[model samples]
Target chain A: MIQAALTFAVTCFALALVFNLWHLARAPGVVDRILALDTMVINAIALLNLYGISQGTPVYFEVSMLIAMVGFVSTVAYCRFILRGNIIE
Target chain B: MLEDTTLIAEIVVSVLLVVAGVFGLVGSLGLVKLDDTMRRLHAPTKATTLGIGGVLIASMIYSAVFLDRLSFHELLITVFLFLTAPITANFIAKSYMHRHVDEGDLPPTEGPYGWAVYDAVPEDERPIDTK
Candidate 1:
């Protein structure tokens, strides 16, 4: 039961990601692409946790946490660059 | 003794997860079709928040049923996601406005935002000026 549920979630999120990338391609501005990318990461993380539990492994949780942290940092960096034209001095 | 009850709980949670996935799909679709960056921002926020929110509720249910306890790790991630995505969106929008709009290009930002005030200062001094 868990496996089936996890599979469904994973499949859905994967499809969403593919669509998101396609959207990014269509989006002309960097901001639109970045926003889409952020949403992609979030979807992936949620799916990651579901996959983790289904497989009976705790490691995926750690990976999900790390992804969340790294993703957030990168988004912030991108924001700085977009705003100031430089991420760092 | 409680087997039937657990099955009932599982059914309810699984339905929620499925619903969440559907919401996410719709949001992704919106991202592709929207005409502008500002409009596109709304799609993901709605999906990532409400859609992902449903998934987390499902997670809480599964953990509670299988592991015999409330699993809060999902909650933490959900909370973190909700908090960060919006801030990122705001920063990205600000950056977009700063870069694309140009100094003279923007209408004067008055009222509580004070964006115009911040935009007026040189980058190095703007941070300190806020204090």
Candidate 2:
């Protein structure tokens, strides 16, 4: 039963992944693309969790945590780039 | 070996998982279909906050009830996401406005520290133009 649900979730979030990438493709500006990428990270996290449930492994949870941290940091960096001329400054 | 109560719990987790997926898809769809940048911001904020919560909650329940080991790791992700999403949104909004919007549309500067000039020197840091 839980395996069926995991399959459904993986499919659903895959569709979301396509949408996010499409948005990234046609984004009118940098910020729009950033938003799309940020969302893509979120979707990926969901997929990771669902996969973990499917496999009954605890390791995927750690991967998901690391992805979450990286996503937030990258979003901040992108916004900082736009707000300032350079990322490091 | 499956008990009736465990069956009900499994069903509940499945429902939560499906709900999370649906919310996530809708939010990403909003990003694709929305015509404006500011409007697009609303979509992912809803997705990241609500959708993530549902999925993580399902994870927590599954680990605790099925795996027989109490799990609060999902809570760390949840709390971190909630705190970060708004902050990232704010910075993105500021970046969007700074680049796309006109200066006249921006709010008045509190001092010489113009928000429009965020990349430049602050009000105090700028060399006094003693002209």
Candidate 3:
């Protein structure tokens, strides 16, 4: 049952990759591109969690948490930069 | 035994996770492929938020099944992410419009939906989408 779940998760990850590729190919404007990148970060974290389970290791959970945090913080930082025209004032 | 029930639950959860990943990927692609920032914003809003969410739920199920413990960590992060991603997108778009419109770099009607947020920008620094 667990293996089944893992397989499903992996398949989804692949699907997300395909869609993200599409966005990269067709989206216009930096804001749109950045938005797409943000989605990538989120999906990547989710993938990490599934990975942790597939391996039956607790370590991946921590990694997932870290990825989530980093993705959010980076998006915030980037958005701020886009708005202010500078990362640092 | 409880094991059988757990197995069933695991299967269900895994299915959910797969669905979520599909949504995430689709959203990401939409974001990248769409033309114009406004159009691109919709992709992440729909797919990524829900897609990552689906994966989180799967993780939660996996942890609960094998570890035989309740886990809520992924849930918390999902909530936080959903809340934040849109706000960030909105801020970026608004700011971009603000800068461009103020400087008359773009006509008031140039942006999709006819954004005039650029009116909020300072005159000198208003940006024009040169690209």
| DockQ, all candidates in order | 0.64, 0.75, 0.58
Residue-level lDDT tens digits of model 1 in A52-76: 6676555676788789888899988
lDDT of each: 0.77, 0.86, 0.70
Stretch of 10 with least lDDT, candidate 3 chain A:
A24-33
The residue-by-residue lDDT of candidate 3 on A1-89, one tens digit each, is 55765676677676776676666566555665566667777777777877776776767767776877787777777867767677777
Cα deviation in Å at residue B84, candidate 3? 1.5
**Docking class of predicted structure 2:** medium
**Candidate 3: which stretches are off by over 4 Å?**
A18-27, B1-4, B99-131
Error of 1 at A82 (Å): 1.4
Q: Assess the local accuracy of residue B80 in candidate 3 as a C-alpha lDDT between 0 and 100.
A: 79
Per-residue lDDT tens digits for candidate 2, residues B1-131, read 56987998899999998888888888998888888899999998887568878888898889888989888888998898889889888988989888888877777878756664444665567688744
Question: How far out, in Å, is residue B22 in model 1?
Answer: 0.8
Tell me the deviation in Å of residue A77 in model 2.
Answer: 0.8
RMSD to the hidden true structure, all candidates: 3.2, 4.3, 6.8
Candidate 3 residue A29 C-alpha distance from true site, Å: 3.0
Model 3 chain B worst lDDT window (10 residues): B111-120
Instruction: Please give the interface root mean square deviation for model 3, in Å.
Output: 2.4
